[model samples]
Each structure stands twice: as structure tokens, then as C-alpha cells.
Target: MNGMWTFLALMMMISAQLQAQFDRSPWSFGLLGGMQRTHFTGTFQSLPGLYNCCKGFDGSSTSMDPFFGGSIRYAITASFGLDMQVEYVQSRGELSAVNTIGNALSFNGSGFDIVEAQSAFMMSWTIPSLGFTPSLAWKPFESGFGIRGGFTLRLQSNGEATGREELIQPKGVVFSDTKSTIRNDRKVNFTPTSLVYGPIIGLCYDMKLSESFTLTPEISYMHILNQLIEFSNSDESLSMSALRAGIMLSYTAFTPARLVEIPITPLPIIEIDTNKPYIPKRLKAKLAAFSVNEQSKEENIVNIVIEEYSSLTMTPLLNFVFFEEGEDKIPARYARLDATDTPMFDIDFIHTPNHVETYLHILNIIGKRMIEKPASIITLTGCNADIQKEKGDMALSMRRAESVKAYLEKVWNVSSNRITIKNRNLPEKHANTQTIMGAQENRRVEITSNEPYIISPIITLDTVRTMNPPIVRFRPQVETDSVSTWQLIAGQQDKELRRFTGEEKVPAFIDWHIGEEMSEGLATDSAIVYAFKARTSLQDSAEIQGMIPIEQVTLHKKKINRVQDREVNTFSLVLFDVRSSEITEGNAQIIEFIKGFVKPNSNISITGFTDRLGDADANQRLAQERADATAKALQVKNKAIVLGKGNSALYDERYPEGRLYTRTVDVIVDTRIDN
Candidate 1:
């Protein structure tokens, strides 16, 4: 009993621990399949009344058997659940005793006797988790496996029993009745009702059947803490065990079914009249220019109805306006126009001019707007004005388009090449006395591509040497009014910045030299100009990280200082390593870092060094190898430099901490030419 409580408490702790790791639902069904072993324990309250010696016998020997069972589960979510199971098991036990008192007066049995018992049984089980259950499968790698444990209450145990028992009642009276007898009992109760607690290890397989339905199969084992069965003759006890397995089919339904919504009906269309004395206010402003060449006004009353637009004069306006109060032309405000945030005459159409006159006329209005808003696209539509117009002919109206183009370039200073002259290709209905008053209304112009008001690019400037050339930066435009800035933010990774833009710049050629001779003695070398940019906060921190090993060309090198700081042949290397000396790894990081530094023609210098661990000769060899290795890593199609200082004293002995300071690489940049 004590062990049972301890095991139950332990299971509770484990369940609670697992519950906190995931999200669990209110109810869950699990299928179980496992084995169980059992042992029997307990004292008998009373023995058979016919047997005097069996009254206080101790059951010294016990036996157990394996069984199969299953459980149904209802979870309250993450912390607790209710469980039920049924099992079929068979068990055996032994008892021994001697008729010590019955042997008096020489009427006694000489030896002690043993009784054996065997039982076949079935039990109903109910268990509740002491702690909450998990809501979700926490370990994906577990492949839908979890652990559960709690205490169980055996509700009912029902089964048949058949066993043989021998008894020694008295020596002389009917000794035959004391012999072993086969007895059969039905529905015998074998186990006591008590809390059976143990650890539960299970695997949960959640099979998605559809959007709402899920099929879960699980197998678990429960270790009983105390023996469930009691001997009919003694107080001795042992642990009881049972096995269970089951499967359940379940379903789920969600509300508010998804479907497509009906679309709203369109508004009714409206018509207009240009010849009417009082024009509809909405259609008048959209017409930029229109004139009625009426030979006789008495009978030829042209009624015009045009569409309304924000700008570009394509809608209702001058072309469809009626002359009221003897006005030569209609004012934009008087015309019925579409009320919009954009004002009249403020719209510009970008065009390539084929007709100069109309082009210029339109440019004047657009250029004035450009002066006010430099970042606006200008559009034009029309042909030369000198072309003759035949009655009811559309193509003839565009012949004089050159006048529009010429006027725009000469007076408004609009580029003639930029102007576009496309004929309106007017259909009679769009212009028939209702839409357009006459031929003039059929000719027109528009503005296109606006440039300016874009955000500046973020620049990353990296240098092999501060003495070399400067870095160059640029950006591309895809369309009007849309621009993304190029910047390197602190601590932001380079790949993250690259997601926004695709350009990067890196330092030029890097060089490495050993001493001064080609094969022996002293050697010197240099690298060509390269490009570079600095890491943005997003790319990395501003504080120096590790060194980057670069290719020779990336780090340009030139002999600037002597071997001993005295006047000597000097070389410059552009791309070189920074914190890391591992030429390969460092080079990879450097190259990736350069992806966001898209600039051009950045000349840098490279200077390589080594630690004083070895002799001058060994140190020189190591330093040259390090520099050369770094240089080869950064070599791209672009010009880069490599420089190697063969242990000619770069760092002092005071910084003998490691190669960190002793084995150092530096870059110098020069900014003069453009590459």
C-alpha cells in the first residue's frame, strides 16, 4: 500500500512534467496493446469452517500470469484525464499448514499438508491522471509518442475459479474426506478494490483523416504498485498486474461552412449632351479641349456625353462642353467633372513626340507641374496639326501631329524624342456629336515616366588599405514612385539584407610577398584594384569580429614600406583575412559578407603577418603561406591584390597573447579612379 501511494505520486509528478510541455485537449481516445505480469498478496479474514488447522495458515508461495486489456480515455486537458479498462487474467497460489493441535491423544495426522489455488478472472478498471495531460504532441522527433501515468481504481473483477485442496481434519474419523478435492466456483472475486498506480509509457499516432476528423492509436503499460490479490489463508501480500488494449472511432464537426460571397451589382450608366445650354457638371471638366465647327447652329444641335476621369483629359470636358452665355471655351470648373482629390490641368501624360505643335501645347501645362512636382510622370497623345481632316475620317485628323511635338520641345523645353504621338483612333460613337463636338476634340496628347523623390541607397565600403581608391555605389529603378533603400543595419545578417536588394561591393586585388627575390632572398608582390563595402548592423556588429581570408586579387598589394620600416620596395594587397586565418572558412564568410557590399572600383591594400613562435625562417614561411592562402580564396573575375610580409617584424613581443595580434592582416584603400 505504501509503495502504491509512492508510485502514484511519482506518476503524478511525471504526468505534470509532460503536461507542461504541450497543449492537450479535453478528451482523447487511445488504443492500447501490451503485456502484464502479476503477484497475489493479503491475509484471509476466515478459513473454511470444516477445517480447524487451515484457520490461520500463511500463504508462503504465490504465482502470477499475463493478460490483455484496453482502456478508454477522457482528458480534461494538459493536467488530468479519466481512464477505463477491462482485462482477462489467470493466477495461482499455494498454502501450507500442519494440524498441530489435532494431533493430541495420539489421534493425529503426522505431517503437514499443502493446498493449491488457481483462478481465471476478468476485471473492469478506471484510472484518472493526477496531473494535466499535454494538449499537443511536444516532441516531433518522438513520432507521436508520449508518456502518461496515474492511479487506477479497479471497479469490478469477475471470473470463474477451479482448484484442488487437501486437508487433515482428524486421524481416525473419515480420513478419506481430508484428501484433495476438486472444487469449482463461478464468478469468484480475486482482487481487492484499491488504487493500482504505476508509470504509463504510450505512443500516440494521430492520423489525419480529413480537415475535422483525426484517428489516434496508442499503446501503454501500467505497473501496479501493490499486489491486487489476497490469499484466503494468510496475511502475506504481493503486486497485481493487468493488460489492456482497445480502439475507438470518433468524429468532429466545425460550424460556419466556407463559401464564395456574391458580388455587388454595378451602378447604372449615365449619358451626357455637349450641345445643351446647361451641361451636366460631372462630364464637363474631363474634356480638356473641344470645339464645334457648326456651319449652321439653328438645326445642328450637337448633344455630347463624355466620361469623367481624375486627369489626362480623356473623360468629359471641353470636347463635350456647350457654349453658355456666349463663351468661346468652357472653363474646367463649369464642366460637369468627376470630383477628385487631383485638380484640373495638373495631369501630365508621358509620350514620345511624333507631332510637335500639340506636344508643346501639352508640355507647357505638364512642365509647369513638373517644376512644382519634379517627380511626376508625363504623358502625351496626338499627331502633327498641319494634317488635313476629311469629314467623318479618323486617320486624317492626326497628320498635323508634328506641330504638337515641335512646339513642346521649342517652347516648353520638353524633349522631342520623349514625346509620343498616338492617334485617338476615335470610333464615331465615342465622338458622335454627343461625346466630341468636332474634329479638334479627336486630336490629343499625355505624360509618362516620373523620376526623382526616391530614397537613397545604403552604402557598405570595405578597403584592403586606406591608401587605395574609393568605393562607388549605385541603384536601379524598376518603375515610377517605387524605390527601396540599400542599407546595412547593425547586427542584421548579410543574407537578410540581400533579401531586400541584390547588389554588393568588395575590396579589390590583394597581394602577398616574401622578402624581395623571385625564388630566394627577399620577395615582393602587389594586387590590382578591387571593390568593398562595410557590414551593416544587420550584417554584423561594427566591432571587429574575426579576420576574413581573401583572394589575392581582392586584396591589392603594393610595396609601400620597407622590411624594417626603412626605405625599401613596398607592395599593397587589397582583399585579406581579418579574424580567421582558416583561408577557406574565413574566405566563405568574407565572400558572403561582400554580397551586400555592391560597389565598384575600390582599391585596397593587404599586409600579412605571423606569430613569433618559430624561428625567423619558419615564421616567414608560415606568414607567406597564410597570406597566399587568403589571397587565393578571394580571387574572383574582378581585380584584387595579395601581399605577404615574410616575418619582417609586424607586431611587437608585448602582444604575444596569440596569433590574434601577432598574425595580423591590414588593408589600405585609395580613391582616385573609377572602375
Candidate 2:
């Protein structure tokens, strides 16, 4: 576990270093040549017969001549960095000895000495946050420092040897024929802890260099204890001290890191019936009282029921209401707490946990999408229409819009600075339509924009396989009436569709009759309709397995220039029996459609249209809702430009009641020229 933690910490350190390595700062990197002075202190009694090895000599604390070396620095920001340095140094100490009782005898006069040398590598960083540099001088007030201890190898070189002297009276000297080969010896401390620490201090400096580089000169010091120890015939203790100074040069490249922004919105809502009556059997001892709809023939109140376990009855029971609309206003008069002979009634209202979670999920998706595409514009419309219609007032709509904007600004990183809300009056068609299904489509928020954004996958089946060539279809501007069609097939064949390889001219398969069954003006008046069969093989069975259910349609529109100004329309589908904005089972199918049909760098024109099941204005809004939903899905897939229209102008002479079939989303792809 310790090793694992160490490895994890190392990885985290590397990651942080990489992330911060590119931060913007005034940086300089250059070779530094400077001098450092060191001295020894502490315990010289451990070894005897060595330099500074007298029997009672204390530790020597003395300064030595300065040595030369170099250093390098990488400043991560204006205040922090990694600094490495190395230096070569020499140190020394000495002691004197005295001889006794040789008035007439001869003796040699000499002194003992030891010279020490070492090389070291120290890593440390400077803390500029502790103080600020003076403006006029370009020097820091104070800089903190950190360092790693270094190792040293000791060597002993005997300078002088003392000779024995003869006494004046009656004493004869005896000589032996033995010589010593251990005149000089050295020792190396192998343990890591043998190293000592040094003092770290703040710095003040001035920086100056060429246009692309800079130079910073700094000073730091370290102090070590226990330098003099004496062993048999030798002294080994060594105290350490250093004063270092150097200049640093650096070249900097900075890639800034900024927080991403997310744009969040409120969840679209649809109301369901919450009105019903309650009854209980075995009405013993007036067990509980019930409430009913206040406006109805009965009263709308909370009902409390309790089953009798035995003769004893509990006086209090808990009644909880966990689901309530956010905008609901509970009236105090409606709080029926009656303690009559019949029993008492009380009401409680609360929001379900599921409801809150669902709303948060919607807002999260919006925020994530916004972060991915920061410059995109988002328009919110159509919420609170039902409340306004019911009350015949526009205040509800305004409140809804403001609430949504607030949620986005507070919950998401998106600032109110970028958001724009338009509180539109209810369309005349929705004046009195209140069916549950109709109201479901009415209580929605539509997102829209005019900018051309990509709304398709970066890759597709055609880009991967060759068996079935993809088909490309487009509708020119309805007002311009310059429509075109073409087929891209793999294996050549003489039939309904044509094939094109590379930049060959786009083949035209003119079959305007396929749309004859569609309402006359529905395709062009409100929106354009374009559909194609997925190209399949007759012999190969595995070729079409697991393919997208519908052929993905790519649109290209033409205006003035054939290559530069066209817009591509994003196409999508809405599943039945579910709200348009909710993420349900149908979402997978929507993704498939984008993958099969949309392409990168393609622009689209999406016109929303609805069946005549609801009033004209309501249908128009529903169409817009579908358009907005399609655009949202497509935006996730890739990029696109989307426009929403309400009801189709196309009409049918026969089977006029079947307008629902005509309700569709039209996508026009542009090669160039028109937007």
C-alpha cells in the first residue's frame, strides 16, 4: 500500500507539472557560472592521528575559499518553478602538536593537516509569493527556497610526520625494522542519511536579458552541524556550509488554461390529471376524514385513513404529499383542518425527488453542450403558454421565461450576459385547445439559431463500406424553385438511380411523382420533404444487417455561388407517446439518423411543419418544437444551421382529414451559394 501510494503521488505530481508547465509568465533560461564557499564544523575527537585530531580539540567552524559551478531554471509562472544546481568545492582544517624533554637532543618541527573535497547536486524552488519586486529596480523583496541534501566523499592526505627524540640522561633508544603502508586512508559514507541539511533563505534580484530571454541572479545559503570526529590515528567529522549565487536564462512558451462554460435551460413540462376522490370502509370511531376537489361538487383536501389494530386508537397519523408542481400556489383557505365530530382534514404538498432530478439532468445536458460549443447562440421560447392561455394573461409567460433564464445563469456557467429571451404571446390557434395530448405539445420550450453549425457525425457507413453507395438529395429554396436530385451508387447499373465517383457531375434522377401522394403545397409552402430508400444488395444477406432503419438524408442548397454560400438542412424524427425534449428510448434512433445522414462541414435548412390535428397556430408551434428538438440532437451529432416553421401550406383535395401524415421535417442540403 505504501508503494502504491508513492507511485500514485508521483503520477499526480507529474500530471500537475505537465498541466502547469505551459502557464504564461516572464521566463528566462541560461547557463550560470558562479562561486560557492563552504566550511566544516563539529566533533573532531572520533579519530586520532588525523588533521584537527588533537585529544581535546572541539569541532572547527571555519569558512573556505569559494568554488565555481552552474545552474538552470524553468519558471512555471511569475512566482514558481524548478531549479537545479551543482558545484565543486574544497574544505580544510588543522591542529598543532607539542613534544616533551629534549633540551640537548635533536627533534624535527612539523604540523598536521587535512584537505577535504566534494561535489554536490541540489534541487530547489523559489517562492515569489512571499514578497514583491521593487518596481524601479526589477528585484524581488524576499524569495523562499527548498533543497534536497547531497553526498560527499572524504580523502585524507598526511602532510607531515613527527619523529621520536632522545632524553638527556641514561636512556638508550631501541629501533625496529617495521615500515607502515597505511600512511594515507580515505572513507565514504554509504548510507543516505549521512548527508546533512542546509539553510534556505529569501532573495532579492534584478532581471535583464535579450528580447527572447532573461537573466535572474539569486543568492541562497545552507548550514550543517557535526563536522569534526576522531578515530584511531585519524579525524573524520566534517561540518558543511555553502553560499551560492547564479544567473538564469529562459525561453518561454505558454498555452493558457481556462474554465469551460456551459449553457443550461429549464426542463419542458406537460401536466397530467391529478384530481380524484377517496373512500374508506369500516368507518369505526370516526377513524379519519377525507377531502375532495374544492371547485367540484366535493372538496379538494388531503384524506387520512387509519386501520384499527385493537381497542386503543392512536390520536395522530402522518400524511405526506410528495408530488407538486413548481408554480402551484397552495391557498390557506383550501387547507381544510376541521376537527368536528366527523374528523379533521389537513393538506401537505411537496415536490418529488424524481422531478427535481429530471430537471437537473436537462440543465446538465444544456450546460455540457454549451461548453463544447461556446460561440453558439441559443434562443428559448414557448414555455408558460398554457398558463397564460388558461388565465388570459401574459404575465405567466414572462415569469416562465425569467425563471428559465435565472436557472441557466445560476446553475450553468453561462452568464446572463450572453442569453436573450423572447416572451411571445400564445398563437391564436392555441386559444382554447386544452386536450391532454394537445397541451403536451403546447407546454414546450423551443431552441433556435440562424448560424450555420455542423449537426452530423464525423464519420459514416459510406466512409467505411462500399457495397451500397450513399444517396445525396437536396431541395433548393422553395421561393427560388431550383430543385435538384442525384444518386451515388457503388456498382454501376442502368436503373432509377445514378452513380458518381469523385468530382464527376451530380446525376439527376427526376422522379417528382414519388411526392405526388403528399399534400400539394405541404412540401413547398411550409417545408420541403426529401426521402430515399436505403441502397441494398439482392445477393448479400449480411450487407444490410444492423444498419440505420432510415436512410440518412444530406441536403445542399444553391444560391449565387455554387461552392461558397449554401446551407445544409439537419433532418430528424420524433417518436410517438413521449415528450419531445425528454431523453427516452427514441434518442438512440435519433443518433442513428444523424450518423447515417449528416456529414461534417455540411450546412442545412430545417423547416418544421405539423399536421392539422390542432389549430393552425398550435400546429405551427408544434412544428417549431420538432425543429428545435431535431436541431438539438443534430448539434450533438455534429454541427448545423436550423430554422423552424409551424404548419405546412401544402393541402390535399382528397382525404383532407389525413393532414397528420403530411406533418414532417424537411432538410435541404447546400453545395454552395445559398444560406
Candidate 3:
């Protein structure tokens, strides 16, 4: 029993390591259990009372009991493999014999009474043990029928014994005879407790339950190779063996030790067979929550500013509300003057919450998409329906363009180089110019640009037998005349592994793996599959697969490129005098540099550092004061930001040469992205 427990502990450790090794192999594991017939064979030295029990026995006995176990099997090839398992079994055996004993006795005063010993006797033994089995298995021609040959290593056993003895005796006076069965009970704490080994042979059949699940039935016999038990002070030796048969069930799947998941948008695939006619699909390519009714002519009356800088068109999601804001109560910022010298109607830029929300929505989509494709550029061209009395139409249009550009640069962190403001200063050339709708239609900004930005619909499938080849089918909403061509591409890392193309507008029942020519884009180890549809020059990424489940991946390539542009400014740091918030050197140089390099929309941040010779709090204050002084020095300070770091500079007075560099200000600058 102790040896069994020790073997169990070792099995746990081995199982963990084997789990990784067999994860990719076509293998199965099962819980094993069965019943076995076991027996002990040997002779015991004669003892005071039990001498006849052993020496007088002329026959041997065997007992049937139940045993349980677990097993793991791995195939080195299609027909040959290894099976390892641990089992526990307990066996009980009994020896019984019938004998007759009688003797003539001298008489008492009257007559002699006779008794006969004609009864039964029984002696039993129980042995419990843990066994480890390692076998070599063969499954001919990839069939389920298999044969295994191995050895069972038996551990020390938990032993016990019990017995019963009975006889007939005389209990009557002379000339009277009566008989009764006299019995004696026997019990002993003994067992066949020693290291033992035996040969094992078995036959089994594997029945599959699912793609990765299976059940196996087997029967095995064990023949002992050595004596299993010996007495300490008596000349007794005992050995044992067994036979077991049972079923085992197992799964060859991932039993996760730890799990992580990420939500992703799956790109949709359009199955296109150029062989079929093109039809409109239920492709709602409108802005969020709004659909386009082509029959109507600009029903919402949104300002449409067309610019040549970027290629994203603003998807307007408003009713005619912008064309309906009360011109009489226009905010001072959005207000324009008239002949009465009063504010007149114009699309509110900042006053109303609803208008701001719409503005922000458009900006967010445009901004985020632009950031994704940095090569794209955006131009804001402003327009007016009529000239204002206070400021000419050109000035008002320029102001609107500037306001829109500032919002993007400040709130969205759009780079200045990527954005341009072009003032049209012209009224709506379309009919609504004399009406309110025309005014709103003429006052707007246009965005014109395009991965990794998740939208909706993720694709995934459970693991399948890679050996048998798998298929993926999807039900797509293919509205007639909407989608032109659908594209499917599967890839790993950053490379395009495979691509499947179709022009058919019918519902797609496409192969997950197209032929090499069609799937030329896929490099295919394991990767995310993306689906796209072509519309003009731009492609819409409609869906993405979380993972591609492939069996027996011989080579896996993980190429990760983390490109972080770490840039350093060549200009020298500004040095400061002791205990002063004044620029001691390079004041003129910094001013000149700011004038040359910093754009009007650019943001400047000056952080001040100090020597560790003063109170920490006071030094922090001094550093801030010094930064403020430097900000004041710059000719352009409208967007300059400042801070202090006390003694937490890159250099400190911890070493002999650090103090000189501590009292300085480091200028770190970046564009404004208001959170």
C-alpha cells in the first residue's frame, strides 16, 4: 500500500510532463478499472496450533476480486505505441479440507464414550497491492483491434487471514449417544508483502465516441515472477498473481491549466462565383445606427465639405436638426452678424450638446481611422451660405476651419503635418442657399483617409481532427446588388498566408482552405482569418477568425515586430543658476529654436530639475518656478505647458560629477490630445 501511494505521487509528476508531449500527438487517455482473479502459492512452517492448516493442505485455492486503474497511451507510429498505467487490486483466498478422526478410549466406571472427528476446516488469506504496468501495443493497419504485452510491478501488500474448524463430539452418558459440531475460529494479520514482478498480456479494442474522445475495452493476465511473501521466524514463503479485464474512456483535447481570451471582430466573407449574376446584398454601409435611402436627396441637410487631402467621407447620422438651430439665439462663438447687427442662424459649433455629440462622433470615427492608416491625410475646408456683417464670409469660414482643425489637433492628437485647413469662403452653390437648410449644408468639414480596429462579428470553430481535414461554412446576409466581390484570407504573424476570392453574390458555402492558387496569401501555421469585400478602391474588412485550428503543425513561426520610435532632440539642455527661477544660458537659443521648429498648434512642455542640496518640497517649487520662467522666455507661449521634478532629474548629486547637470530644465514636447 505504501509503495502504491509513492508510485501515485510519481505518476502525477510524470503525467504533467507527458501532457505537453502528447498534446499534439494523435493519442488518447482513459480511466482503467476491472476485476481480477488472484491467488497465493507456497508452504508455511509448522506452528503450535496452525501446523496442520499449512502442512496438511494438499490443494491450492484462488479468489476473484475487483481492481481499478488509469492508463495513458501514445503512438509512435500508425501501428505501434506505448501504454502505461497504475492499478490497485485486493485478492482473498481460502483453503478448505474435510477429515475424519476417531480414537478408542478406556472406560470410565460404567462404559467408554466415543466421539468422532468428521467435519470441515477452512483457512483464508487476503492481499491488497498497487501495481504499475508498462506495455508495448500494436494496432494492425490502423484498425481499433490491438494487442499489448508488458510487465506488472507489484508493491508490498496489505495482508490478512481468517479460518474456521469444526468436528463432531460425544456428550452423552453410557448407552446414550448425542453429537454436536464443535468449531474453532482462526484469524491472523499476515499477508504476501514483498516486491514482486510479473509478465502481462492483453487484447483491447478502441471505440471512438467523438472526434477527440474514445473508449477502450481490454482483458489482461499477469504471471508472478518471484516470491511475494516470507515469514520472519518461520520457514514460510508465499507468491501471488492476477487477471483483470475492464473498459477505459479518454479524451485527446486541451485540459487547460490557465486560460486567456480576447474579443475580436471577425471580417465577413462574401462567397462570389463570377459565374452568377451580381445582386444587391443587405450591405448597410452607413454611419452608425443610420441607413441610407438613395431615393431621397440629402433629407438630413448636413454640411458636406469636400476636400482633396484625405480619401474618409463623413457618414452623416443626423436628421435636419443642424439646419433647424434657432439663428436668433446663436451662441457668441457660432453667432454671425446681419444688417440689424444681431447674431444670425448658423450651425452651432460648441453651444448645443446634441450638435457637439454629432460633431464628436464624426470626428472620432475619422480620427481613429486616420490614426490607423498614418499615410492618409485630412483637409478641413469650411464654407458659408451668406456673408456675416461683423466678419466677412471668408473670415467666418476661416474661423470655422480653424476651430475644426484645433479640435482634432487638441482633442484627438492628430498630427499637424497630416491635417490642412482650406478656407473656401463661398456660399452653398446648391438651391437651399436662400433657406435655412442651405446655410447648414454649406457650413462643414470633410474627412478623407483607413486595421486592427475591431468593429463587429467574430468567427471561430471548435478544434477538429486535423488528420481528416476540416470544413467551415457560414450563413451570410447576402442582399442582392449590395456587395460586389467577397474575399477570404487566412494568415499567421503579419504575412498573408492564403486568399480565396469570389464574385458570386449568393450565400457563401466556401472552403476554409482554398487551393494554393486561390490561397496564395496564406502562409498558414495557425493564424487569424480575415474576410473583406471590395467597394471601389477601398476594401471593407468585415470579419475575423479568432483562431485557425490545424492539426499536426510541424513548423510554427512567431515573428513579432514591436517598432517604438524613440527619438532624441539634438538641442542642448538649458542650464540654471543656483537657487534661481531664471534662465542662466541658452535663453536666446531656446527662443530662436521655438520660433523655427514649433508650429502655432504645437504644444511645448518644459520640465525643471534641481540639485539635491535643498529641501525636497522647496526644490520642487523652485523647479516649477524655473520652468515657468523658461516658458515665459519663449516668444510663442500660447500652448506651452510646464512642470517641476525637484531632485528627480535624470542626474542627481549621488556622484561627484552629477551636481552640475541637476539644476537644469529638459524640454519634452508633443501634440495635444485632450483626454
Candidate 4:
């Protein structure tokens, strides 16, 4: 025992020394040897006809046995393994009778003496067996401590039993021997069970002894489930339990280590001059030329020809007012009248020489005409785009018509019965449905009058003006290494007329139309001034200002020439679809109207324009194609000046409507009236 304790201490020291280097192997083989203490339970009986001292013995006994085994292990994972052990075990047991007999013995020589003697029976057995334990092993922590659980199968060889009688009291009386062997070694009456099975549980600790060897100390307990011995004469059986302690020396097969190589590259070095100073590139801008109609003449004067006329009549106002999608109210651009304001609303006071302005007051015009001619009736038909949010929405269409009717009834005092309101999915003369502009044009209210004159165009005697070289072109030159953005703002003095802005680089040329910019009112007859500004990404800026002279005609000179009345009419045909020069039905009608005003002595100007899309050269060709198509459709006899302006936006290109309006052909007809 002392040597055993010393060996355990030495193993503990070795385990501590090798703990860090310990690595469990996937396959291991080992040999194990141990001492086991077996506990015998139940009953042990004597042979049926051979017992001399007693019949049987009951209760339990404990004895020491020897067990030697070899194990093979397979690791399923880092912390779990399967172990199978085959062991040869020798088992032994002893049992004594609980009750002792006290008998009287008689001596013949004395003829009347009596002696009391007490005796007991003892029984013992031995079993030599081979045990197979297949178990699951688990190492729960990083340390070597582990636990194992499984069942054991034991196959027993033949076993032997013996019985003895022992004297308990009166040892020195008549009998001299205190103990006596009543039964010698004999085979058990019944054969020991051939096969035995039971459950076993164990604990172990692994101690590394070398690079490939591990020493494990383990303890286990097995409960025998079957009888070891059975008696034929009685209902007697025997069982045993083993508590075992052992050590295993195992050899672990290890795999060899491998090495990998990697390549390295060197970086290039850069040199710098210490005394040099760094300077950023500079930005530059120049107002190259602010001229009219790209003209290079020194006197860039825009001629404003104010023509006097005795009477001028605008015939046939457009009958449709367009609306936005999914809307029931009239657009704000249309002129509206209140009940109080209607009494003072005179047709002459509201009439404008501009056709677009006159068209905006169509509702008021219809209402005023209805008030004048009470018998005249008109119909208002509301239409929708018939797609997307407005698809099949008859109620919304009706509401839109009602909105128009309500305006005429409330403001103009036109009787509701005199005005008929109707709704439809789309206008009879619908534009291209696939395009956005076409869809927008379809959402409108159409007006028709019973009397032709009621909805006819407004006629007024007024003076009109035209600009010579109508377009004022500006060219700016910017020089920079990193100029981010630039802007050109044109105005008369302080009021900005038009502002053009762009990024990266400024365009080669920018144009401003005099008639269009001065539509509100001519601010000055002297000169038009503009400012050009440019900026870099670094916030550096450059600015310049320039002015263009204006040639103005006085109003008195127009009165003197009033006898020679001149009529000027302008019309625009809007192209909605991109890269399309085909004249739509509506545009064809507009061209017919233009042809009606054309005469042998008429001065006609037709200019075609494209939106800011596609390459400049392509747009130029497209504009020319549109102009040629319009000219051919008109079939005018007189000579006409036609031009194609490429990608020069006449309207703001940022909005869809503005871009749609830019793709157009403009025709202006100036006729001299013989007095």
C-alpha cells in the first residue's frame, strides 16, 4: 500500500509536467491490470446429497479478485471516444451460516456425563470468467479527468464450491479440534451460469508518460444481474458485484506535421525635393461674345418693330384646358373670376393680344357670351388620361366637368341648365397615349358652343411688335484646370430676365429670345445687361458683366402708320415623342390653320427646334427634318425662311412639360393690309 501511494504521487508529478504537451489521439491501444473486490449476495447452498455439516448458508460475503485486460479505443471527436476492453477475471466468495447448533455429547466410560458443543457451517465458491466491456468515454474538461459508462458481458468457465463446519464453543471439551472441514472441494450441484451481464460505470485520469504513450488510472463498479450459482433442491441463488481499480498504459498513433511556404515582394521607393513649393492650378473665365443671333457685327442692336394695325381679330380659341393626372379641380394657370369681380370684368379689359393669354380665359369668355346671348347653350366634356390612377374613373371625370360648370355658374351667373356637363375616358382627338405629354394632354375639359360666335376667337384692334434677329445669342469662354460650374444671368439693369446654369464646363453658346423674354412688358428701350459668373471646386470664382443695345420704335410713329394696318400671327406645333418628325392629327390641323394665313405677299418664318437630348448633330438633323416636313405639309406658294436650331432649349429642360414644349416648330406670318 505504501509503494502504491508513492507510485500514484510520482504519476501525478509526471502528469503535471506533460499536461501542456498532451494531445488526445484518434486511435489508441492499451493494456490494463487491476485488483477487484467482489461482494456476494443472496444464498449459497450445499450439494443436495453430499452435505455433512449443514444444509445451506444464506446472507453475503466480500472477497478480493484479480483482473487483467487489453483495450482498444477509437476517438469520435476531440472530447469523446469509444473503448472496448476484454478482461480475464477471477472471482471468489465466502458465506457462513447464521444459526449455530448446540448439541449434547455422551461419554461411554463415565456412563452418565453430558457436554454441550456449538458448531457453525461455512461455504465458499470461486468463478473464473472473461469480461467484455464496451463503453463510451468522455473528457469533460481540458484536464485529464474523464468518465465512462457501459455494460459488461461475462462468460464464466466451470466453478467450484466447498462447505466446512466450525466449533464455536467448548473447544477443549470432548472434541480437541475447534474447527473441522466437513466437506472437501466439490463441484457445485448445478452448473454456474454460462453467461452473465450487468451494468458498469467508471472514472479515469490520463497521465502522459512519453510522446506516444499515456498512463491512465481508472476505477469502476459492475453489478452482476444473473445468478452465479443455482441449487436444484432449494430456491437458492448467488450473485456478485465488483468494485475495481486499475491502470492502463496506452500507445497513441500520431500523424506527422506539415509546413507551408509563402512568397514576399518589395515595394518601390519615391523621392521628393525638400526645397520646392507646391502650387495649385489656376481657374479662368472670359465673357467671349454677347451678340444677337450669333451675329459678329459690332453694333449688336435688337430691332423691335412695333406694327400699328386698325383692327386685328384672333379667330378660334382653343377649346381644351389641360389638367394634371388624378385631379378634379382646374389648374391655377387658368384665369378664374369671382361673383363680385365678374360685374367689372369687361371682355375688352381682359382681352390680351397674346393668343395664349386669350385662351386661358375661355371659361370667362363662354360665360360672358352666355350672359349676352341667353338662348345660347354650351357643353363641357371632361376627359381623363384613361391609364394609371385615372383609369376607368368616371366619377372623377364627372367631378372635373362639374368643376368647370360650377365656375361658370357661380362667377358668370350662367344658368346650369344652359350648360351641359359630360364625362369620358379620353378626348376624341387624343394625342399619343404612350408618351407622358400625350397622357397629360388627354386629361382635359373640352368646350363646345351651340352658337359658333360665342366660342370664336377674340378680335381686338391693337399694336403688335416683332424683334429683328429675334434670338440673342451669348458665347462664353472659360479656361481652367478644375472649374466645377458656371452661370450666365441676363437682365435689364437689376431685374434678371433669364439665368442659365451648368456643371463641369460652360456651353459654347447660349440664346435668349427677345420677344419671349419681354412678353410681360419691355423693361427698357435702352440696353440689356447681363452678368457671367464661374466657380471652381475650391470655391474660387470669376465674374464679368456685359450689355446689348436695343433699337426701339416709338408709339406715335405706330399711330401715323396705323392707316397701313399690318397683321402678324404666330403659331406653334408641339412635338411630344422623342426623335419623331411625323405630324400628328392635331399638328396637321395646326398646319392647315397656318396655311390659311399664308398669302403671296406674306413674310413667313418657320423655325424648328429639338429638346436637349441626343447628340447635337443628330438633334440638328432631326430639327431640319421637322422643319422640312412642316413646310411640305403647309404647301405654301410664297418663299419662306426656314431654319433648324439644334439642342438649343427654348424652354426649361428640367421639367417634362418644359422639355415637351421645346420640341416644336414655330411659324410666324406677317401680312400687309391694303388700306
Question: Best-fitting candidate, measured by TM-score?
Answer: 4
Model 1 regions more than 4 Å off = 1-146, 156-195, 209-215, 230-235, 241-248, 251-675
TM-score of 2: 0.22
Model 3, span 447-519: residue lDDT tens: 3331222111111121111121222333244423445566655555766755667664534444442222323
Q: How much lDDT does candidate 2 score? A: 0.35
Give one digit per residue, the lDDT tens place, for model 4 in 1-675: 999999999999987766544544589999999999999886645643346455566788898888898999998987899999999987988787734455655555666355566666667777899999999999987789999999999999877666666665544443334334232334453357789999999999999897689999999999989877556745777778989999999999755434346687877887888799876666667774433543534334444443333334443466776777899888887899778987777777666544456566777888888888989988989899898998888888889899999998889888888989899998876766776776887888888888877766565555566555566677788777767888888776577778899998688888777656664455357576788898999888889887776655545554555545567776777743458788876678677767788888888788888876668999998888888788888875247888889797665554434555577787778887654
Task: Report the number of the highest-lDDT candidate.
Answer: 4
Cα displacement (angstroms), candidate 1, residue 580, comes to 34
Q: Residue 159 lDDT in model 4? A: 70
Against the true structure, candidate 1 has what lDDT? 0.34
- Model-by-model lDDT, in order? 0.34, 0.35, 0.53, 0.75
TM-score of 1: 0.26
* Deviation from native of the Cα of residue 331 in model 4, angstroms: 3.9
Model 2 lDDT-worst window of ten: 312-321
TM-scores of the candidates are: 0.26, 0.22, 0.31, 0.40
User: Candidate 4: where is the Cα deviation over 4 Å?
Assistant: 1-296, 299-316, 323-325, 346-359, 431-439, 454-461, 466-567, 572-597, 608-634, 643-665, 671-675
Better of 2 and 4 by TM-score: 4
Model 2 per-residue lDDT at 176: 21
Summing lDDT over every window of 10 consecutive residues in candidate 3, give the lowest-scoring window: 304-313
> Whose TM-score is higher: candidate 1's or candidate 4's?
4
10 residues in a row with least lDDT, candidate 4: 176-185
